[model samples]
Target: MSLFRLDASILPGTSSSAELADLVEAEWTAAHPGAPVTRRHLGTNPLPSDAWPLAHTGNLTPEPERTPAQREAMALAGTLVAELEAAEAVLLAVPLYNFGVSQHFKAWVDLIIAGAPVGSPVLKDKPTILTTVRGGGYAPGTPREGWDHSTPYLRRILADVWQGDLVIVERELTLAGVSPAMAHLKDLADDLHAKALDAAREAGRQLAAK
Candidate 1:
C-alpha cells in the first residue's frame, strides 16, 4: 500500500501540526508494515514567487532563462499534482492561518485545482483525510466556528476538484497554555488524532485491497 502525506506547517519547530502528521504516519506504518510512504513538506520548499504569476495565468510551461524561478516552480507544482493524481489516498496536515489553510497549502491547492475544469473538477473522486491544528476551537456549529474557514474552505476545494470523501480532525484552542483548559484541548486533539489514524488506515486498506 502507498500513502501520500502533505505537511503544510510554515513554522520550523515541533509544531502540533507536524506531530499530528507524524502520528498518522507512524500509525499507518505500524498497521500496514512494509507499506510505501511519501511525505511532502511544502513549507521547506516554497514555490517560486514567479510561480504565482505563471500559474495564475493558466500556463504550465514558462521560459527557462527568462523565468528561471518560475521554471522550477511550475515543475514542482506539476509534479505534486501528478503525485496526487496517482495516489489512492491522501493525508494532509494543515494548520489554520488566519482562519484557513496555510499559504503553502494554498499554493499546492492552486496547482492541483488549476488542472480541474472551472466547474467540473478532475481530482474529485479521491478520498482525503485532513487534520488541522489551531490555537483555538473552530469546529462547525460552535460560536467561533464561523470564523473558521479551515474545514469549510477545504471542503469547498475538495468539492470543486472531485469529491470521493472528506474527513476532518481538528485540534483547537492550542494557545490557551498548559492549564486545565489546554490540557482538555490536548486530550481532544489526541482523540481526533486517533480517529484520523483510523480513517487513514482504513483508507489505505481499502486502496490496497483494490
Candidate 2:
C-alpha cells in the first residue's frame, strides 16, 4: 500500500499547511516504515492553467479526430486519475489564498473530474487527510465569520464528490505572529497552531490504522 500526497502551498518551504501535512506524513511513515510515498508539489511545479479546459474538451472529442494538444491533455488527466486510483491513502495540504482555493489546485481538480466518469466516487473508502491553513480566524462569531470559502469547497470535493473517508486538520490565525495587524491575537494563534498539530498526528494515526 502506498500513500499519495499532494501539496498545493505556493510558499512550499514555509507553508503552515505543509508543516501540518509533514506531521501526518511522518506518522504514516512511522506506521509503515518501508512504504513508498508518491508526491506531487503543485506549488513548485504548477499544472498549466489551460490544461483543464483542453482535457474537458478532449474527453468530448473523438479519439481519431482529437488534436495533438487535446490528446496530450487527455493523457495527462488519465495519469492524474491513475495516481489517485493506485494509492491506498491520500494526503493533501492546501492553504486558503484570498479566502478561496488556489488556482493551481482548482486546475488539478478539474483535470481529475475531466478524466473520471461523471459523478463517480474515485476515492471511495480511501482514507484521506486534508490539512487546510487559514491566515485569519473565521469562526462562527469571529469578524470574518462566513468569509472562509475554502474549507466547504474542499469538503465537497474530497468527501462528497470523490467519496473519500475524509479527515481535516485546520488551523486559523496563521498570520497573527507575522502580521502587525494581528499581533494582539498572537497567543490565540499559538493555541490554534498547537491544536492543529495534535489533530494532524491523530489524523495520521487513523490513516495508518486504516
Candidate 3:
C-alpha cells in the first residue's frame, strides 16, 4: 500500500501538520510494515507559490515558456498530481490560518483539483484525513464557533478530487492568552495527538484491507 503525506505548514521545523504526519506515519508503518510512504512538505520547501495565475489562465498557449519560478511551480503541480495518482491513502494536515487554510495549502489544492471528470477526479474515491490545529477551539455548538472553513472547504474539494470520505480532527483554543473560557492549548494538543493516532491506525487498517 502507498500513502501520501502532504504537509502544508508555513512554520519551519515545528508545524502541527508535521507533528501529525510524524505520528500518523509512525502508527501506519508500525501496523503495515514495508508500506511505501511519499512525504511532501510544501510549506518549508515549497516548489513555487504561483499556481494561481497559471491555473487560471484561459489560453493553453505556451505563454513565452516560463520564468524559473513559474517552471518550479508547474513542476510542483505535476509532482502533486503524480503523487495523488499513485497513493491509496492521503493525510492532509492543514492548520487553520485566519479561519481557513493557508494560501500555500490552497495553492497545492488548486493544482490537484482540476475541473475535469464531473464525478471522478484524480483524488476521486480515495480516503483522506484532514487535521487542523488552532489557538482556540471551533467545535460545533460551541460559542465563538460556527465558522469553520477548514474542513468544509476540504470536504468539498476532496469530494471533487477523490470523491472519498473526508475525516477531520480539529484542535482549537490550544494557544495561550485566549479567554480562560477556552481549553488549555497543551491539553488540546495532547488530546488531538491521541485522536490523530487512532484515526491514522484506522486509516492504515482500512487502506490495507482495500
TM-score against native, each model: 0.73, 0.99, 0.76
The candidate maximizing TM-score is 2
- Which candidate, 1 or 2, has the higher TM-score? 2
For candidate 1, give the lDDT of residue 42: 82
For each candidate, what is the lDDT?
0.66, 0.94, 0.66
- Tens digits of per-residue lDDT, candidate 1, 44-92, equal 8775555656654535453443465555555666676777767766778
Q: Provide the lowest-lDDT 10-residue window in model 2.
A: 56-65
Best by lDDT: 2
lDDT of 3: 0.66
**lDDT of candidate 2?**
0.94
Q: Candidate 1 — which pairs collide?
A: 124-161, 124-162, 124-163, 135-174, 136-173
